[model samples]
Target: MWIEGAKQAGVEAHPWDNLAEEPLPTSVEIEGTTVPVKWLPKPELGESGGDLRNVVFVYESAEPHLRLRWQWQARGDFGPVEHRITIENLGGQEVWLLMVDSLRLDWKVTPTQNLRNVYVEKGADSPSAEGTHLETVSDGYNWKGKSSTYAHPVKDEKREIIPAEIVCDSNGNGWYAGVEFSGRTRISLERNGTSLKSVLGLDPEPGPFKTRLGPGETFETPTVFLGAFRGGPDGAGNQLRPWVRAVLGNPVTWKDPQYPLMVNNSWGSGMQVDEPLALKMIGESKELGLEMFHVDAGWFRGVGDWYSEPKKFPHGLAFIADAAHREGLRFGIWTDWTQAALDTESGALNVRDPKVSDWLVTDLKPDWKPEDFKGQTIDIGVPEAHDWAAKEVKRIVEDYHLDMLEHDGYLVAQGCVQTDHPHGPPNRSTMRVIHDWASDFVLASNSTDVSYHAVRAYYDIYEKTRREHPGLLFEICNDGSRMVDFGSAAHGDYFSITDTYDPLSNRRAFYDTSHLLPAAMLESYVEKWPVPKPENFLYMLRSGMMGWITIMTDTTAWTPEQHEAARKAFELYKAQLRPFIRDAQMFHISARPDGVHWDGLEYWDATRGKGVVYAFRGSIPDEAGHHFILAGLQANKHYRLHFEDGSQPDHEVSGSELLGQGLSVRLWNPLSSELVFLDEVAARK
Candidate 1:
């Protein structure tokens, strides 16, 4: 509630009554240069003395749910900076932190101790090949491992941080960095040659670190940094000041890379397009402003069949490629490079074939039916295998003039299972087999406009793809949020718009996703599978804006209404792009277990001087009183309000009136609705 460090900085308490509507502040001045700070909440004050300086930033918003204060403090500077961040539970009930980032790249280390609580490996040769195991301290927490050296460079090796790039300006003058670590959820630092720009961070820690809470108990963790240079010491505390400001100011520039939107056709039917159908799909996609149209499975003949199934498509794969190109869209094709369907007439296994052993599964039972045959996986690690893949890929690229290569089912492998393959020894860890497989994939698929795939394991694969191919885009498919960890979202080029298994679920899935992921990573289907109602269409349109919103249906089947809806969704999504995707904080206001009642999420954009609060009824049971209270509204300015799905008509009010008196949104049997207010809404009197 009280900030002890600000007094040292010659600042005031900036009481709640006088606090700004935003959670973070804009424009903080260190030394002389005053850069913009995005959002500022009131700070929490604690006892300060004896070398410890404490500062807390509190965000109060009722739209999504309640008020939360993020506390950051500096204490030990035994050469390097050591800082601790505390997430105080201003709310009365218990909450889940869900995600936390705590890495600071500025601190150079001969070896570092990363915060990984669990480690699972298939065998000795796996990447989880560490000598030590994570020791459990409490039920949900484990002690940090002692710093250890690695045989080679590991990027986010523990799946703790997001994908971060070590980019040097054209002259290699500037270095922008970001990584996740313990205590602190994420730390991003931007340094241009000399002056250390502001550091930014976020704290989703529900309570104190290590100690899980019981209703009102708190959880906190410290994000530490150590370095040397112009701005000052790279101590944890010093590194924190700028980062907290960055989190608060909501800076637009992120050193981490951004990915693009892509439309895939795997979830639906096969892609051996029925001539008339393929042509129709391409035409509709171009009309809907589609970018890449990927033709999924059924193209190749053999499981390891590199050739087209001429029977399925009369003209062969080249026809589809030419059609996509003529339609003003890039042609993308799918490859099960690491798989041999085993059903293709000539798809039998042989020791001579590099992928043969990898595809053969002695693990299969004699009683197993044809469909029950445990699928065979290929060995992509073998040199000859790599060459085979390269030659096959080269043929497709050359013959079809393809713009992108979609690698799928490259996940399941058998040759490298337990037997000796062309690559190495037997009984290898699945992870290593996959990692090595990924390395070869890059070489095999890299010579194109985009090299994308849907992977299951190895988080660094996203970084590898982006690093090797700067302009490349990765379509991450990890079954909704299974592989959708903080590190993946932070570093991957793009999020898979939807789970491959369930394409229709994304409409509601988008709400839960908005808590952390960006809208640019979402995907949708424009054409009707079951025919999304107008309300359902608006739901997807509203939430999909957080990432890449794409249509995944049979593009050829979009009706007149669906076409218009797609256009509307895209336009609306682009309109909210600023706060929804770029440099904005996604606040989870409320929780809905049944997902039937109104669940809320708020987006604050310090750059645009605007904010958006979204609320939706997951599933309604009985008519219960559900109200959404808004807290970030500025005082003394007139604001307009309405629902995204047109459930609530336009209403006007002043910020001052809603400051202490938050907006209480009440709905009866509501399906999905969004309330939008202009920047003037924050100026309300």
Candidate 2:
């Protein structure tokens, strides 16, 4: 699997163009035999024109009937290149396809090589101490990372990363790669002698990885993207983020001016929302300038029952949607559509029902009872289960007249104990279950296989739903940040980045995740925190406003002054900050938020020739003012600064002075924030 690299100072330059390599960049194994393949170039490369290039390299093995289609393509002339392998079984007999790695690159380096391996963890349950990890990879280094529908990391275990890796020198000159499958996938980086090998694709763990390809059946590996870069992490991100927006992001969603609309959620009251509370919140949402009203985790008849509670809202959810639309706001509801319970209602999916019981991941205890909201996991890998879930989603959307649908909690299968399912049977001896956070999670030998089938089905369901309702937005919130990866980015509109909602935790999660995703797609739920003062409230509000923001609080309960301040803040976010937030290059201008010192984020849009700095002061009383250096500006340009809070007089300065001498921000109180915006000024004639 090793490929030669261009030698520079006895160390090879990492191959940036993986597709053009001789022989092939990947291979497939049949039974125990490794198939040999050579390139058969095609004459008519479809759509190989300006700003896009597409090519198919047909590879023929020794066997006449077996051939591989290596499709490599890119939407833009620059940025990363993506490719996937298709194993075709054209012969009459079926064959087992095993060990088809998506990408295998061997980077030769010196034994004394000095490089940093950087990756970020999914903020599954909450923000961990090591959200973004950067470590030195030396002569004897081996690192393996995994991603799935949900992230489960035990104590002292290396947390599950976002299925991507970056290996670069101190100068940030290196290559990065990631997988585009929302299933059980992995990336590994290992260094031995002069070989630093990386393999990314489907994870074949817990033993025998096998998928059958009958005659005329084709199996495609998960697509992976790889790119070489010269700048550091931020530099890598600047190039990667725009490419993702163009290639992976939905064009229909972006065409809406308020794509990442402001949201006011009803979770501040927890699961006790009634019709009166919902109507009240809808009124307050309009007065506060929020664009959407979200009803969370309540309003349902029962667990697994998708009907509105008759007592809570006698008129059903359609009535609530009509109210929000009357106020000119979008209405979204939360659902765990794949979860099943004991509800005996006519339309409810009861786990104890004879047919539904078969789809359950495991046999429930005789006396098992369902939580008020949480329920048993279903194996959507089964065709019957998949079809039922798909139909249910479309029905719910139409019945409720929903503008958006948010799926929370574990809605996908990561592990199962069913032998009769398409993922095949699990080794019952290896089957182990743990009850955590009010649900059972299975672990078996075929855990990866179970996830593979379920994720594909999940993608299929969403694709079909999108085709039917073009404007419907889908939110991927696996109990808050577990499903934050490239695959979900392609399928869903935005991600709820964390379960914790404190200002510090919100900033921490945003800091870690914004490195690998677009700022407009990362949702930070600003829950009701201790905002004892107006400035503290602004501080809390601005913390999550850096990305897609959702305020999960009762705006009706705010004092008059707080309400006035929030209205102004929301107006400012919509008019002055959102454009930069949506299309600017983000930088961590200060240290990560510790709530003890000053911290901030900088957004500079070179195309717009303007940007803003969101600065915050911490609890330390003595550190009133902090100096900050900025990025993504011209050194010789003159800039005009405007302070949104007027903490300081509006002024002008040279970009060199701002970048080198630093912008000074002074705050008289702790737990306060300021927004300082800057734009390019005309040079003196």
Which candidate ranks first by lDDT, i.e. highest?
A: 2
What local distance difference test score does each model get?
A: 0.40, 0.83
Estimate, for each residue in 608-661, the C-alpha lDDT of model 1 and write its tens digit: 656667655554756344554444446756666655555557677677654545
CA shift of 502, model 2, Å = 0.4
lDDT of 2 by residue, 1-685 (tens): 1111112111235533333233342344455566544445444533233323455567654452566777666654456777788877777765666657787877767677678888988887778887888888887789999988888867888777888888888667888889998888899998778778889988888646666566787777888887666667887787777777888888889888997899999999999998999999999999999999999999898878989999999988999999999999999999999998888989899988988888888888878888878988898988999999999999999999999999987888878877778775777887889876556788777787788788888999999999999989999998988877888899899999888999988988998888888899999998888888788999999999998999998777789999999999999999989999789988878876788999888999888789999999999999999988988888899899998989999999889988997889998899999999999998889
TM-score list, all predictions = 0.53, 0.93
TM-score of model 2 vs. true structure: 0.93
Looking at model 2, residue 226 earns an lDDT score of 74
Relative to the true structure, candidate 1 reaches a TM of 0.53
Off by over 4 Å in 2: 1-52, 60-65, 91-94, 110-113
How many clashes in each structure?
Answer: 81, 1
